[model samples]
Target: MAEAQEDEKVGGFLGWIERTGNKLPDPVVIFFYLALVLIAISVVCALAGLTALHPTQVNADGNPLVVMSQSLLSGENIAKFWVEMTKTFSHFHPLGYVLVVMLGAGVAERSGLFGAAMRAALGNAPKVILTPMVALIAMIANHAADAAYVVMIPLAGIMFHAAGRHPIAGIAAAFAGVSGGFSANILPGQLDVLLFGITEIAVEGSQLDPSWTMNVAGNWWFIFVLTFIYLPVIWYVTDKIIEPRLAKTPFSNTASADESVQDPSAKLSSNEKKGLNRAGLALLLVVGVWLVMTFGPGTPLIDEPACPAAVEAEGQCAAVQRLAPFFKSLVGGFMVLFLGAGWAYGSAVGTVKNHRDLVSMMAEGMRDMGYYLVLAFAAAHFVALFNWSNLGLIFAIHGAAGIEASGLPLPIAMGLIVLLSATLNLFVGSASAKWALLAPVLVPMLMLLGVSPEGATAIYRVGDGATNIITPLMVYFPLVLVFARRWSKDFGLGSLTAMMIPYSVWMLVTGLLLVVLWVFLGLDLGPAAPIAYSLPGN
Candidate 1:
């Protein structure tokens, strides 16, 4: 037994190096290093008189690097520096939005909603389809925020075990969908809308493309195509590659044991049966109401009422326009949706007894997220610091300038941006923050190269999505750590990294190819979305 324990420890350590030796630079150490370097650069640039209010040289290649000095820093611009810093720390819209919804989702999960619903939902699907279907379901559940992380990853083991398949494969498949397939989706999600809004903000900031706009479907057409591409790739990697490697191991878990041991004698009580009916009815009502609200005229579900008189008098476009906020408010919107759903389900299902119970459910939700929220706080602040330093902008500016100098055609340049995103994903993981930092530089740079904002944004999404499965900095990486432990007792961070590295490599290659193909085909990302440069200032 001692020998086995020692073996596990040695194996775990070796595995860690084997997997993460290439990527696990101590972020804490790196943070301080980058901060000092950036401060020095800022100080030197200031001393050298190279500080500009804005980086405004158009068509200039190889702009000389200037060290920033202290005197060049302004008290007025101090506010702007802090604001940019804050944007990094508080950059993730999906993080907050998902957490808010998870509060209610937590309550429902605590109340046995997921297990009950899953049993009912998958009662009849074939075993072969179970793994992929779980992946697909988790993909859909992203609309509910991070419920997939809370519910699906662990449940995959249980569900797969019941079907007499490898539970690890199940977990891998689901994890692949949730994180690996991060950016590709069949439907428009809150992240889609949020990223699009930021992309538009970035394009407008560049002044090279004021007319460029990114709608909700900016990446939809390409993502939808990639969904088919991803499913097969994920399934092949899991079933063919990952499963074979794990089959030699004996780290079986008990999570799936219960799923396979269902007793025929066990049955729902009369009250339980009635509760199920009520829950079903409530779910139907939710779907019905949402449809009505989304489609009905004068319903105010989507947009704010247009005050044409005010617009005409002020000579301002409707800046605070309708329904636009709903898309932006996805987190808050989902919080209410989950809270309402949990309450209704609890009451109808006789699980939630009163208002106290409802509050408890939300509290329970927040409680489950103690670790997650903390990580988010750290991630937010780190991101904020990166932004404040403006290093990301410098990198993007230099990169865009280099791409232009390469004299690459529009299609190749777009593809290169996607590749750049995948490479950048190695260190930075926040999509919005990275895009916010990158877009300001790349958006206008690409416009000058004759790529439209929507096209540039789409390429960015492909790189961002493809790298998610592999990056340790990805917020969900720790969760994937726990998932890996189910299959191998010695599994730790390195094990998870080893398991996912293949998927990341292949997906990065294939995803980039797909993005290039989209550009080649001259695809419309959405209604009024164009693939190439529109008439200047259109």
Candidate 2:
């Protein structure tokens, strides 16, 4: 009853958000509509003589180059768009990254390697520390990306119920860690490659820093710190606030016996134990191969000749420049890691028998990605249209000029970015799609303000993650509600959102402060990723 009252109070505002968000078109449709809008806007801007001085480019006379808006409706651009449509979608930077990672991830998940690993991590955890343990594992489970949602959340409920605690509280804790702390992983993974790849495109398109390239670990340190910061937040919210509120609510297991949910506290089968042991060994071997390629006789992953003369003048190549090849190779490394580890586990557990089974697993993964492929097609065209329109760069330059003229402090500027991203996440749930749209403008705008591309990406991540739990638009929100309903059949959207509001509120506040502090301290976001950038030749 108390929970219901609380839900009503929180529902007033968030309910409106839910309704409005639901009315919005599908993300793919939104991108298609946005591309149409960009075309119309470009036509007007081109006619109105819209232009911005290119920050890094100069004409033959050594004057700043004038970037003019190009009308998408013009004859040449229309032909170019149709001619390059296939190439544009196929070459979309994040397309291959996500697909490749998911190929291996599909095998690991279907082979039960991912599920077994998550269960083993949380199964034996002590009750006193179960909340934090669940929180930590949930965050780390993001390496498995969306697969974590299906495997971890339900298992958490079972573990909590077995421990004589409210299962809803366990689900809340895991959900909070997984979605609310989406960007707070201890190590870089597929998301790193995806977001940074987009960042690279934004940089290249802006022509701001030709030397700038994507680093998968760009936000490594920031996210590493975020993991520890978010763990206690989840722990305290679950144990003290959410659980006590739910203590009066009656608990019932409404799920049928045949449901796939498992009692993780139960002992593992002999074959499962053997599979886990083999999976670990296989993962180690994969890492060893990468190490050998990186450090062996030829140093295959090192680009010695690509080192900058500026760094050479300092007597050594910068660590970032030296390891550029290695960093890029992480994409393939992750694919191989998941594939090899999963194949080993499957072989041990009899889920896989030979190369034919492996080929089948890869195909299944691609089939699951059909929706993403469609969405990517729309998003790729939208980005391509935006770049051709010149509005993205124009708006960025003018916006940066306004900021510069107003003398807004860099920290405050970044804080506003976090707020903007949080607001937008309520409407668009796909992180990659959201970043693809925002990166072109935000990355270049922040770069003009002397902020690094990685810094801009980090700030956006903080906002993108914190609001994910409260928003019904998030793709996983309804799925998580189903998990919650297995325990409390009467639970509604309002109830779940209300329960998660505290986690979202506290996380947003903590994340904003951390980002501001990072800016003030002038800290490195990751290896060779500084919080500030100076325009070349400045």
Candidate with best lDDT:
2
The 10-residue segment with the lowest total lDDT in model 2 = 3-12
Question: What is candidate 1's lDDT per residue for 437-467, written digit by digit as tens?
Answer: 5665677566655567777777888788777
Clashes of each: 19, 0
lDDT of 2 by residue, 1-538 (tens): 7764454343477988987998998998888788888899999999999999998889999999999999999998999899998999888888988888888988988888988889889987988899999999999998887768988998898888888899999999999998999999999887888888788878877888887767888899999999999999999999999999999877786552426787688788888889999999999999899899899888899887777677788865556778888888888888888999899999988899898998899899889999989988888888888888888889999999999899989899899999999999988988888998999999999999989999999999999999999998898988898888788767878888989999999999999999999999999999888988888877
Q: Which parts of model 1 are misplaced by more than 4 Å?
A: 1-72, 79-119, 143-147, 193-218, 251-255, 258-295, 299-336, 363-401, 427-439, 447-458, 468-496, 526-538
The lowest-lDDT stretch of 10 consecutive residues in candidate 1 is 64-73
lDDT values for all models: 0.61, 0.88
All candidates: TM-score: 0.71, 0.96
